[model samples]
Target: MSVVWYFDFISPFAWLQWPHIKALAEERPVTLRPVLLAGVLDRVGQKGPAEIPAKREFIYRHVLWRARQAGYPLHFPPRHPFNPLAALRLCIAAGSGVPATEAIFDWIWGQGREGDTIEALAPVATGLGIAEPAAAVADPAVKAQLKANFEAAMAEGVFGVPTLSIDGRLFWGSDAHDFALACLRDPDLWEEAEMHRVAHLPVGASRL
Candidate 1:
């Protein structure tokens, strides 16, 4: 089973899930699917939670509690950018073994910037002990490839960031973290549970 992490760097929930989502794969066959989150949101007419006063308030309280429970650092970012696809693309090209993956998430969600240029990203990249050349990836090809990745995601029915898509079923939002983790960490239990929260978990008669 595979997990597609349709995330935008602007999503605090996506940021919050990064460490745990990676942990869920410790003993599993999961890979990160980084896509252009803004494209999904724009195409779907979905707005970032931070733009919604009530929803933003809701998420702040929710994330604080989840952070406490998850035992990880958490804070609402001071500023939120509407687009994060470029940042996600850089990380996608970055090897999975690199430490910069978390740095990318933190730079966006913790410090509240997309690290748009190589100069901007270099600090985070090297801080995480990864060598990031600001010039090498300036080619048009890199940008094109990233755009194509987003297109592919849309073809898969992805309409929002923090979307967890497995097979053809889509679970959108930060609240679905438990189901996503369960789908990866405890697939059988997910299937057996009343609601197969994650998309691909075998459900209905499939559970039996």
Candidate 2:
């Protein structure tokens, strides 16, 4: 069983999920499925968090509180409503080596101005031995990979970032953590959960 996490850089909930999501991988392999939240939102025709100021702030504070309880350092990012695709692409490319990705993400979310450009993401990428700062951002292959990842996520019924999928069942919220753990521990539980999810869904939704 694998857990594929979808997240947008702009999401504080994703921020909340980051620390605990690792637990699902202990003694097990959890794949990080980074996808563009904006891309998923496009298919769902939903606006991002920035559009819902009051609701976003409410959710942000709640998630931040959870992060604090989880012992993660966090602060409201300095730049509100920022674009994170450039930053996210680096995370996807970094794959298992997401220390740089976490650093940049934490720095920005901890009230830092690190999301200004793809140029800024390069230093983080270079430090990770993945690519030169300029090369990764400029490379068409990186762009295409990011785009493809987003598309695949869309196909998976992923409508947001920070989504975790296990054993082909999609869990949309941080609150679904327990069920995710259950799916990871038992293959039979996974099969049961998969059928439960499919049974609830309407016709035409296929696993992607």
TM-scores for all candidates? 0.72, 0.81
Give model 2's TM-score versus the native structure. 0.81
Model 2 regions more than 4 Å off: 93-96, 187-208
Q: How many residue pairs clash in each candidate at the backbone level? A: 0, 4
Best by lDDT: 2
Task: List, residue by residue over 1-208, the lDDT tens digit for candidate 1.
Answer: 7666666666667777777667755765555666666667688877866678998888778877887887767655444544554466567556533255677877765655545566666776566544655543554666676677688778888877677776545667767877766665666664664555564555557432
lDDT of each: 0.65, 0.70
The superposed Cα distance between candidate 1 and the true structure at residue 171, in angstroms, equals: 2.6
Question: Candidate 2 on 5-56: residue-level lDDT in tens?
Answer: 7766777777777766766555567777566777788789888776798977
Show model 1 residue runs off by greater than 4 Å.
Answer: 82-86, 96-98, 110-117, 127-132, 181-208
Predict model 1's lDDT versus the native: 0.65
Residue pairs of candidate 1 with colliding backbone atoms: none
